[model samples]
Target: FNQNRDQITEQLFRLFDLLSITLSLLLSMWLYSTQFSQQYFIAGTLAMLCYLLISSATNIYHLQPGRDINHHSGLVIFSSILTFMILLIAASMTKTTADYSRVTITLWFFLMCLFLIAWRVSFRRIRLNWFKDKRNLKRVAIIGANDIGNQIATSIKENVSFGYQFKGFFDDRKESDERTAKNLAGSIIGSFDDVVHSARNKEIDVLYIALPMAAEQRIITLLDKLSDSAIAVHIIPNFFIYNILHARWHNIGSYQALSIYDTPFYGAGSLLKKIEDMIIAAFILLLIIIPMLLIALAIKLTSPGPVIFKQKRYGINGKELIIYKFRSMTTCDDGRAVKQAEKNDPRITPLGAFLRRTSMDELPQFVNVLQGTMSVVGPRPHAVAHNEEYRRQIGGYMLRHLVKPGITGWAQINGFRGETKELQLMKQRIKYDLDYIRNWSLMWDIKIIIQTIFKGFINKNAY
Candidate 1:
């Protein structure tokens, strides 16, 4: 049987999006006191064609793993922008730019993107609350007792709005086998025979075959048995589960390559990240320029060093970047054996203590953000000495360098700012940093920036 579940979901998204596009264009027409014209109709048709192709290619309308509300909104806006640009390019090529009203095109672009995001959010909220229908809810079962199977179960359990009710797993392995389930929902309730019986009885709506490739014959046998039930079944490939952090497919001359330890900031993702950093950094730099200048002057008068201390730190892809901050210490330690600043350390001047406590010392780093050496929200770059030392001792420590360093970060906001003297503390900080890299979005960055404004600054841990 085909996947009626995903088919129905995709149809709903596709239909609603087309309707939104049509309505947005009509509104734009009404706004400009213009009636429908051939040019307008042509533009609209081309936009819809571009959207369908791009959206389908990117799998935008489908529910996927690791796609949160922000992720959905980002993809929708991205697809809409591409559609708008394609239409503009087509118009330019046909030398028909003068045929359509610029005002109408501008209004349509704005309204289309806005309406697309708004309608999806509104639909999600209403579907979850106002409708309260449970017809689409499916009872799912996994045929494997492995890591990927358990991960799938966890995803289903967590995304309650997806309307999946996991009905435990099915495995033939004995209790002593290493493949037995661990800490998963419901645990192994039955074997393959039981799963088939339940499927035939109409108790199981969806079946996920997460068996290893080595069990090809066993999988074929199971598939043959489940063929009679008419229940939808899908296979969970082991390769896709090998690494989940920033995992995405790349096409190289018609070949698919999976990057295990890769950065998310590539191609359009890189542009989006830079745009986010630039806009936020510019706004912040304007607001704090005066305060940063005052802090720089204070450091100059109090400390016997440069007002702006630049130290070597690892940036994106482990590139050495000169990170900027107001010199809050009496000495500038940029050497191989830089010391971690400690509370009441003699190296810290009186003014430096207040600056660090209030996080005014980091104000200068906003300039670094504007200069593209850093980001407004990312993993904070450690001292070159700290980075080198921890890379050897801490697992996945160097992975934090996958993104540009930042003035404020998930780690800093979660009280990992200031000196991490203990190895365990540094490990915890790196963990949060990696987490941020794994699930970064513009909305996530904005959330961190807002959190930083309220409570991230003036942390008790800050020296």
Candidate 2:
């Protein structure tokens, strides 16, 4: 019944979007002229197709219950803009730009945007009211009494606006003190058998299985007991035991596989990241071209050996990549042991010390971003020797390589930049790096970039 409801809602959403676009087009056409034009009809149909394709790809039509109205509005505007761009491209390709009236096209685009926003706002209003009513809430239960189960209960309890009411926990373990069990946050309502009985009576609407992966037989038995009922069952996998590194689910033909360690960038996300890197790198390079040239000249004149120093560092997924920097020291250490630059290090020349303090030495890494070997924001790549040494010394240290290294990272913004002479300091830096990877988002990247611009560049700790 829930499946059918979802299917119906999805169908309605699509139909509503189609109707909105069609009505907007019709209104525009009528305002321009009473007579129907074939060119306008063709353009309208193409626009609708563009909207459908783009919206579906972006999941713009999948309206979650109690979803924020502003978020949906943003999606609507984004979809509308993409559709408009597609229409313009199609018109240009067909050389039929002059055939359709500009006023009508403009009217249609704005009207479509207005209609989409209005529809979503109205839907959100009604849905929020529905969610506000306690009687309409779905009863949810969690199986097991472990960490994951407690977390699930806490999440559900905190998100009361999601239209789910916690129905308590169902664990097989017997508690000697009923008072203690009753006082627990996810109050132990009953045993496993009682959960099966409640499901049979249609009391529970959703059941989340948070049992350990080792409890295969017990989980299977519980499934069998609830198989005859309509309660929806979900399993929350516990990957904390193995110390997951950027884990994600993948389907291999008919089998489902869980990747314990992997890069997050895939498909559209990878494309978006590449585009972001290229656009930002190109802009920044254009602005700093002369500055970089001056820095190179200073390095050559002041330092005896080279203008640019290349260091073999670990890149994405632990692959070796040559990192570029303005030679900031008298001795170029690209060997087995590379010492980190210190505040009063004698190797740093006069000009080199100034560059290092202001972070001008790392400007060449923007070129690395353009090369697709680095990101504008990510875990800063350590030298290969440092990576090898730290991986053994620190737990989950190597997971930072799951993403492309950055010029400035979350660790840098939070004062973890510069020399790490102590193992504990490296551990703290690694902790921030892993946190950045685990919580990576395009907005998060942009935020870090903005923060870097404001405060990350000039640090007293950068030699």
Please provide, for model 2 over 1-463, each residue's C-alpha lDDT reduced to its tens digit, 9 standing for 90 to 100.
Answer: 7678878887898889999999999998889884567887887788888888877765666646544565566667777887899889988999999888888889888999999889877876787688778789999998876666877788788765567999888886655454333334577778888988999999889999988879889889999989999888987876574445356688999998887666778899889888988999999999999999988887787769988889999998789999999988888887578777788999999998999998999999998999999988889888777787889999888888888999889999878999888898888898888777766677667656655766788887889
Name the 10 consecutive residues with the lowest summed lDDT in model 1.
238-247
Cα error, candidate 1, residue 448 (Å): 15
- What's the true lDDT of residue 105 in model 1? 84
Model 1 TM-score (2 dp): 0.56
Clashing pairs in 2: none
Deviation from native of the Cα of residue 114 in model 1, angstroms: 4.9
Candidate 1 stretches greater than 4 Å from native: 1-15, 31-59, 74-114, 125-135, 144-148, 172-182, 210-229, 237-309, 315-321, 324-463
Kindly list the per-residue Cα lDDT of model 1 for residues 1-463, writing each as its tens digit: 2468778978888988888889999999999988798989988888888888777765677666334566567667767877888888888999999888889889998898888889878877875663245566788899988778988898888876756778888988754576586676557879877988999999989999999888999999999989898798998876435454357788899799876667778889899999988887788788878887787777777667788888899898899988777888888899699888888889888998988899888887877887898988889888898889999999888988888888889898778998777898998898899778877777667657656765678888788
TM for every model, in the order presented, reads 0.56, 0.63
Error of 1 at 319 (Å): 6.4
* Candidate 2 C-alpha error for residue 461, in Å: 21
